[model samples]
Target: MKRRLVRKLLFGAAFICLLSTQAFAQDGYRMWLSYDLIENPDKLSEYREMINYVSIPLSSPTLEAAGEELTPGLSGLLGEDIATTNQMQNGTIVVGTPGTSDLIAGLSLDDELNQLGPEGYFIEHRVVDGNHLMIIASNEEIGVLYGVFAFLRQLQTLQDLEGLSLKSSPKVEFRVVNHWDNLDRLVERGYAGLSLWDWGSLPHYEDPRYVDYARINASVGINATAINNVNADPKILTDQFLTKVAALADVFRPYGIQTFLSVSFNSPVDIGGLETADPLNPDVADWWESKVDEIYEKIPDFGGFLVKADSEGQPGPHGYGRTHAEGANMLADALAPHDGIVFWRAFVYDPAQTDRFREAYDEFVPLDGQFADNVILQVKNGPIDFQPREPFSPLFGAMEETNTMIELQVTQEYFGFDLHLAYMGPLFTEALTSDTYAKGEGSTVARVVDGSLFGYEHTGMAGVINPGSDRNWTGHPFVQSSWYSFGRLAWDHTLTAEEIAEEWIQMTYSTDEEFIEPVKEMMMMSRDAGVNYRMPIGLTHLYAQGHHYGPAPWTADLPRPDWTAVYYHKADENGVGFDRTATGSNAVDQYQEPVASRFRDLNRISDDYLLWFHHVSWDYEMNTGRPLWNELVHKYYSGVEQVREMQNLWNRTEGLIGSQRFEEVKSLLEIQERDAIHWRNACILYFQSVNNLPIPNGYEAPDHTLDYYKALEHTKYVPDPWYN
Candidate 1:
């Protein structure tokens, strides 16, 4: 059954009431798209004067979507129903492509439109033939739809529209969201509810929620999405599942989103009954070619494959002694025919390597130029797994000959899951704005992924996001901010984290300064707070085994050496950090000059990454003039305090934001405080045991002993193996 119908039947008339109250209730289901009536009479009057009628001179499905969204959205914000007109009027907001609209064609905007490419758009307030017209013009219908959303955003954020002139084009070509969802409805690392895709009912009963999903993504300029776990199951490629995927593609297509799939590299053997799945094998290549053809027949605008080959246990070309280039090129060849691209993940690691941080760089740097033009190596933001804090991946700018895309995890896999309000805007901007020093000082990671630094053919940014069956999409109300910020930054990297947060706060919640200022500060400080509590002072990977939530600093019983906490921390009597300088792993040398020199120099390095690049003694003096041990304790305690401050900040806005969401956030902040304390106590005690350091003179002693914290079961916070 369709989930929406099931919801209606189960709830009856109460569901209808819920929909009516949604705007005021702040259920979070509407995310930032909620269009509440403007309370300021003057602002509402101005908006009404500017947008009396929405005039779209086109008839395409995309242009129709623009009209559908604009008319109702304006009506809600202006507190009056907006009319649609076929003729040009003084108060009309005209939106369309030049070819579709004679009014747009007559504007002689050929030079301006030429620069917008396919997905770019412009919104201008101009006096055309003595009529004040708000013109939203683009080169294509989808771009017009984007412009419609952009125009609404100005009203939603309460921006002054007196002399508005805005033009935007995505810095990256492919802005995508990758859902690590499985066929059985279980989401890997997903704290939100079940997978959004109801495979059981799909290909027959379409869900209305799918349209909303596409709308939300399109609202933030996300143009593509991969619909399954990268640890792909071969059945997704079969005829039975292709039909279901096609149904989803149809829903996403009208919103300018192309659907991609995560393909198992062993599909030739697992599903096709072949002897081997080697990329070099003729039969294996032919099997992929046939499968590509079959998929195109189902989804003509399919965005192609996202492969996790040769990583973690997924099968790849390595079994046949073929390089990554060989494997990627083989699939790229099949996809290139249909203008599809291959997103080959460069998240590989070898157990034999002394440092896991150097594994991806070592493996892929040599074969950078060999991969096909259609293949993009999707590298993680950090070289290590998504730890709370780590240096930018050395691979970001190292592969000068490759087309690279940054893959950032929006789900809080290593950042306290759904419990902690760890906003990721700062985290994303930190990585993007980091100086790679590849082509000199201005060569940022953002430039590399956006195809400017290396001048590569393909460029993109993919977020590993969680939007599941939960009413709010993501479990924590704040997670929507990360997903929103990621899409905005992916569209244009120049936008600041603070700018996006303020916009999100104004749109999603209340626009009053009492609510916006404090809430924005909390979101901006959230990521740093998470890092301070869990892995402060460049410490990382101290989470419990398998589940990766809560602390387990002494855990060393894992099967692989690299899988244990001891491998990353290297805590001992002498000190408590892994050494990655010349004397140790030499990972700093991987970065270009100046950046390498700064990281290697103890005095020059930021204390934020002191322990990341060098192992310092407990008694060693820090930039704060305190011992390293004292500084460590200070950061851990400060993190818990920050959460408390966040709670206070949120409490001030009570009765300002709707009571429903205010209470929800209030309750989550309490849980977050408890979790923060747990992390602080467990981590500090465990490290103190190794260093034998006393708590700094002014600090309060730990509530529990090291053994007490260690003896606490994993279930004290979250259950092991998220599937349960």
Candidate 2:
């Protein structure tokens, strides 16, 4: 009897050990969708009681995706297996479109749904048979899928679901992610890892990763995706590639996410065998119309084309001496018949132009009202490329006749790559909330992009997505907040940066109040810290050639004069910074009278953006009562100090968060500290070389010479996927 009892006890212990090992193997590839087992038993019990079963009536791909996501999430979170049913049971959660479910149709909710639009959903709790039931209803099946994710999010955030009644809708019509991904699976400016789309195995072997990708995107407010780099390949429009694109579109459709293509402007001539691709030419117009027709046939709900014509060596109507309006309107006309819109990029600049910052404004402001109704001129946040700190683009309110979409880079191209912990939420808010003062005092860039300022029909926001095939989605785990923040801001631009950081922290790391507060502070200060250390006081674009890794303030001899770091900084013994006032580049004159005048006066200009508009003497007195030279030195030193503080804050969190994530962040903070010092040393050393100024009394001098800093090269820097 003793021997039998011993054998049974040993078997039970072995079985329990195997289960523990299985649980440990699950990494965070699922991201916030992980739905890990809830640690709080009382909370788990309550969730299980609230969600006992799920009823999904619709059976489309998106509907199926919703069902698939819900089962795993609920099973993991509630610690119970929640079965799916065709009909609503007592205490059931019914999720479907109004057309398919009687419970949804009979609620007289169609009118409310019309107000909510096709992408919105209504979540309500109804009591039937003395049992409470939750209903997630939408005007379309895809909305139902979004509703499911929304419901799950509320649970994940530990929000009260009892007596829940809410109708949520996207403020913008189109919230899209522009992936600078190439056919070779490389992502341009993508620091995460390889491209998420497995092109080599696509159109045949459907990777499950694609489905998860759509699920996470739908969970946020992202409704559309442009799959290729804006500097596009004409071959993508060929028949063979259409099949591959169609396959991915089908995968995304059920999640309410439409797929868009970035088409090369010369596709008509390059792919259709036309002699010339001029917009006014009849054959060119006909070819585009036919090509769009072919795309729509393959994927009926294809979003549209994202064109980078006449920008950065890409072909456009400028090649034929035609206006940008003519080029965009031609594509707009082709897509108009199918209800598709054209996103014409306003990133034009010429290498030959003396002032690169003035190029886009000069090119597009003149042809503002000539674009077709179905076209949106996509403008980057700043006049120049995605610099760490820049003045708001003059084009935001300049083009009143055309629809505008704010293009933001979620990827940290100029700010620091994945190695540094820079949260871009504050950076995004700075640009969005900046008062352009075009129509009036309250005319902000957010209002311009959301269609409220101009009172135009179409307006939207697009972020260059930072996702890659890395196990953590984004390379640095914390960098995921930038992606999340972009979608949240796109959904509602009014959200404060602090609020977004709090939400991301609670959902991503821990809901524990202790972890949330300090981490939120760290995220809030991160962007400004990066700016101070890397490019303080409005100095811009001093990154090294090609890789853009670190300081290269002395880089003056590149093929294009504008490509050099010195072209922007203009640091010398006399002064530092670009002169964009009336006397110099006159870039500030592009804004309204009040804004331009405010920037014209060096005293009136904010010190943060002082160098962006005006070149000042090294001895100029700043508002801080210190000379410009002293203030600049203080900012650089303070930036490095702030990075050390971030590391200290993270170290205190060692035992408070998950071991794996904590260790990952801890190591990243170390890298960030080292690089922050590198930035401080390199930038200060180079500036001191130009200014011939001594290092301030108390601050430490750089350990190396300016030549030593310049000799450092990153030849092994990974080329953006598209560049390769």
Among these predictions, the greatest lDDT belongs to 1
User: What would the TM-scores of all predictions be?
Assistant: 0.97, 0.94
In the predicted model 2, the residue pairs found to clash are 62-254, 186-721, 187-721
Q: In the order shown, what is each candidate's alpha-carbon RMSD? A: 2.7, 6.4
Candidate 2's TM-score reads 0.94
Q: How would you encode candidate 1's per-residue C-alpha lDDT over 421-498 as one tens digit per residue?
A: 999999999999999999999999999999898899999999999778988899888999999999999999999999
For candidate 2, write residues 1-724 as lDDT tens digits: 3522333354334323322425532344655665656655666677777788888874465676677677767776676788877655766898877777776676577666887777788898888667678889888877787788888877777777788887888878889999998877778888888888777776875666676677778888799999999989888898888888988897787678889999998988887888899999998999999999999999999989999999779999989989999999999999998999898899988998878989988988889789999899899999889888888899988989989999998887876777889898998999999998988899999999999988776878999975898877788777788888888889889989898888777666677777877788888888988998999999988888778878788888788989888899888899988899878989888998688998889869999889888778889999999999999999999999998888877777778876877888888888888788888888898888888888889998778887787787443234455333
lDDT of 2: 0.82
For each candidate, the alpha-carbon lDDT, in order, equals: 0.88, 0.82
Q: So what's the TM-score on candidate 1?
A: 0.97
Clashes of each: 0, 3
